[model samples]
Target: MFEFAWPWAFALLPLPWLIALIAGKQKHHSTLMLRIHALAHMGMTNTKVTPSRKWPHWLLAIVWALVVASAANPVFRGEPITLSEPGRDIMLAVDLSGSMREQDMAYQGRFVDRLSVVKAVLSEFISQRRGDQLGLILFADTAFLQTPLTRDVDTVAQMLEESQIGLVGRATAIGDALGLSVKRFNEKSQSNKVVILLTDGQNTAGNLKPEEALILAKDAGVKVYTVGVGADGRNQGGLFSMLGSSGAMLDESLLKTIAEQTGGQYFRATDTQSLANIYKELDALEPQAEQEQTFRPVDALFYLPLSGALLMLFLAALWRQLKQQAVVGDA
Candidate 1:
């Protein structure tokens, strides 16, 4: 719909008319009389009087109307737009300790490190969270919030993929990762707050303990899904298998406790496929909302009327100039 933003401008419509009336009165009062005898001597009595050329009064009135309309600031309001409100605020915490450098996880028949496999699978997972705000946390000796909770999942995913082992330090800070996630969740009012914490080793560094972080999560009403990433079965052909040694030691019990205490579940990801499956399960658990909220959009249309007023003024000036030139030529 069209509407004036400043309807008060209409009150100035009679200003030009008032000015013209006052000027006419002043001209009439100042009229020079008295020179009948002088005019007869100068041949003014029989001289042909040339009528003064004037522009149509209605044309001036149209210009005034255009200027008034432009001052009113017209606008066109568009229809309301509906947007889907996100159903969940999810934070992804990945371990970047030295242990993540171990090449125990396999991706497409090739051996890859735990961090590499996590990035490959988690990137896809992050993309699938269409209606959920995602954040990233990287932990080693200390945990750091890589990205804040945001609707731009692509940026979060890119940060996740760019993460490298030992970026923070060589020791795993599982507790710190959870603590940071909980702290971020406390800032938002969303009811469905979730954290997906993936780690390969136990907590060897950090100020807060796992139990303390779990308590904080429970108090903040944040659900945490924990995953212990490592090798599943015995290595059949690797050098570690020849020496009868297993891969890195993962603290599964602590992870399970954290998840269970926060009303979430625990999953073990020994390979890329299992990690992908875990994220798929998470997607099923936290679904996007069906109903969406809406808002109206408005666009200003003042420029359209203002441009018309300017164009008309230009044409009027050109017409007046051409008429004056024609009169001069005839004279």
Candidate 2:
């Protein structure tokens, strides 16, 4: 729809018409005349010729109308739009043990270690996420924060890339990882916080037990999705160097119990493909509702009317100049 922002300016449109009427009605002085007495008695021929030019006032009035219309500032109305979405905050707990280096899981038709496939697929996963706050926790024997809960996924991914096994030693502390993740979630309410824990081995170090950490998560109202990652027996070759053979073992039962206690489901990722699928499924889960937001930018349209006024003024000026030249030639 079209509308004028300054509709009051339209009232000025009639001013030029009133001025033209007054100017046209003004009286001009009579020219000097001399007459002889005998000429009054003679017969005379009379012919009527109608005047072709009465007024050019309408041209000037139209120019003024254009100027006023231009000043009114017209704009097009925009349509309303609707969008629906859920809101939630998520924290990802990743295991950085040396055993994660085992090359037994198949991904994209090739075999890569649990961590290698995870890093690749999860990086893509993080990129696609929107409107969710995310954080990262890396654990070995001890737990360390790769990043705190944040809305910036790129920072989280960069921290994930920098994670290595030896930062907290070669031991697997599932409890400490959960505890740290829960501690980070403490900053937010339980209903809004969630944890996705991925590990390849049972807990070996940490003050808290798996059940105890789950209790903390339950009290906080934070949901926990536990993912146990590793292949079956003999996947780790005898020639393994950086990671010992013991790293390949996964405590699935403990992970299940933790998830169940926190009102979340546990998942087993025996291969990289299954791990990727599990994360994708988690992405589909709905989050809590958040406050809605909107923004609008205004655009000025005064130039359109101003251009028309300019053209009208130019035409009037040209017509006046041509009339003046013609009068001069006739004289």
Candidate 3:
């Protein structure tokens, strides 16, 4: 893929030779003592002048021509890459109410809270989505955008994992979460816009209603997938159940309606394995489009050829000076 960007400059390569020829024919007069002729007169010693050491200058000129050619930006194009999986933009809306601390979901024969498992699984999920712009929204009594839509998935995940329950008070504002997600998505609507809403309770707080938020999402061409997490029915008082002190049930119908309104589906994750499976199923819902991109590395090949030419010029000049000094010494 090597190419000379300035092929027209080759025409000037022979111009130096013309200058050399003209220089050789230029008339010049020099005075010298002619003892053999017994001429004391200042006679004309003019003769056709030629370079005694022409090869150095010729090499120097040729090298300079090459340097000029290299400086014209000779380029080597590399192969292009096809990013088969086109990136998408996703916003994860998580519920961080007091109920999220319920330790009903079992993981490896032990019960863990909803948030613990969510963090563990989400960390892995975010890793798989490279090149995609991801965001985080945590909602409880009020919905707050923890991170804006960005390509930095690591930062988004870190912020999500660092979030604690009751950051905005202890109430589940499902509608506000969806509304905020819709607003964020509308800020920069991409080819594929999505919101993964995970909540363990119903909307008890926020200015907007669930139906109103769903309408906003539909209007903005945004898809909303709702996930209702926690075990179904009620759990009797156990040794370490956080919900043992109170009675509550997750609002599946509202979550289902939100998902249906925005061309998405509702997923019920009662346990860790089911939650993992639900996310795995979601992985297939949105297929990435193949994209092609071109990349050209801007390498500075000028230094290579320039350095070589400079070194040659230096050596030539030094040799000429040394030859002149040697001639003077011999005389």
Candidate 4:
């Protein structure tokens, strides 16, 4: 549909005529180079006013109308699009600690780093989130809001994809990640706040402790689904307390407790398939709202009339110049 954003601008259509009427009348006095009536005709040159051309005035009127039409901001609006309004506000905190560089997660039968696999699966998940405000937090020694909570899922996905291991530091700050996520959610008014924190290790480095962050999450009413990501054989020993080499890295107990306390769930993603499945489960849990929301795509058409007006003015000016040249040649 075609419409005007500023229809009132059409009232300016008569402005040119008003200005012409007000300024049109002027006193013209010819110089009297005579001593008296006897010498009045002695080499007296009278100034002659050229007759105004009708075409120029008519052309200008048309230009004024076009300019006014342009000022009215003509727009072409496309058909209305009904979409489900975003109800869920999901925050994704992916571990960017050095351990995330571990090639334990499998993709297409080949072993890839945990971060790569997570990016692949999570980007797909983010793309599928049609009507959800998504945020991203990349955490290592601390958590950074890579992308704010926004309906632009592509940006969130791109941030996740561009993340590098140890971009911040070399230690997993799970507590800091959780705390930041909760803090962000509390700043918003949305009731459906969710945080998906994926980590291959426990709270190794950060100011906030995992327990403290868990309490914060619960208090803030933020649902946190913790995913313990890594290959099973590589991580062994204790689920609660610290154990052998890199074995104690994946703290399943702490993750489970965090999820349960915050009325969320914990999943152990031993491989890529399980990681994707975990997200699928989350989809089933917090499905996108099915209610109706709509918007119309609009395109500005003011430029069309505006450019036409400019071109018309240029052509009129050229034509007037050519006509003047022809008259001079005839003279």
| lDDT for predicted candidate 1 compared with the true structure | 0.83
lDDT of 3 by residue, 1-331 (tens): 6666666766776777888688755532222233433342224554432235655566968686867776666666566644534478889999898877777777778877778888878778887777778899999989999999887889998998899877888788888999998888777735588899998888888999988888888989888888888776355444324543222477888888888888999998878888888879888987554565656654445566667888888888899889978876776
Model 1: per-residue Cα lDDT over 193-257, one tens digit each? 89999987788899999989988999999999999888953444554434333344677889899
- Per-prediction TM-score, please? 0.81, 0.62, 0.80, 0.67
Residue 293, model 1: lDDT of 88
- Best of the two (1, 4) by TM-score: 1
Stretches of candidate 3 off by over 4 Å are 18-55, 238-248, 294-300, 327-331
- Pairs of residues at least 3 apart in sequence or in different chains that clash in candidate 4: none
Which of 2 and 4 is the better model by TM-score?
4
Residue 143 of model 4 has an lDDT of 90
The RMSD (Cα, Å) of candidate 3 is: 5.2
Query: What are the Cα lDDT values of the candidates?
Result: 0.83, 0.74, 0.77, 0.84
Name the TM-score of candidate 3.
0.80
Clashes of 1: 0
Give the per-residue Cα lDDT of candidate 3 at 157: 84
Per-residue alpha-carbon lDDT of model 4 for 1-331, expressed as tens digits? 9999999999999998897677656421222322353254433755332344666677888899999999999999999998788868999999988777766666988877778999999999999987889999999999989999999999998888889987999788999999999889888875588999999887889999999998898888999999988886553333322333142358999999999998899998888899899999999888877878789999999999999999998988899889888876776
Question: CA lDDT of 295 in candidate 4?
Answer: 94
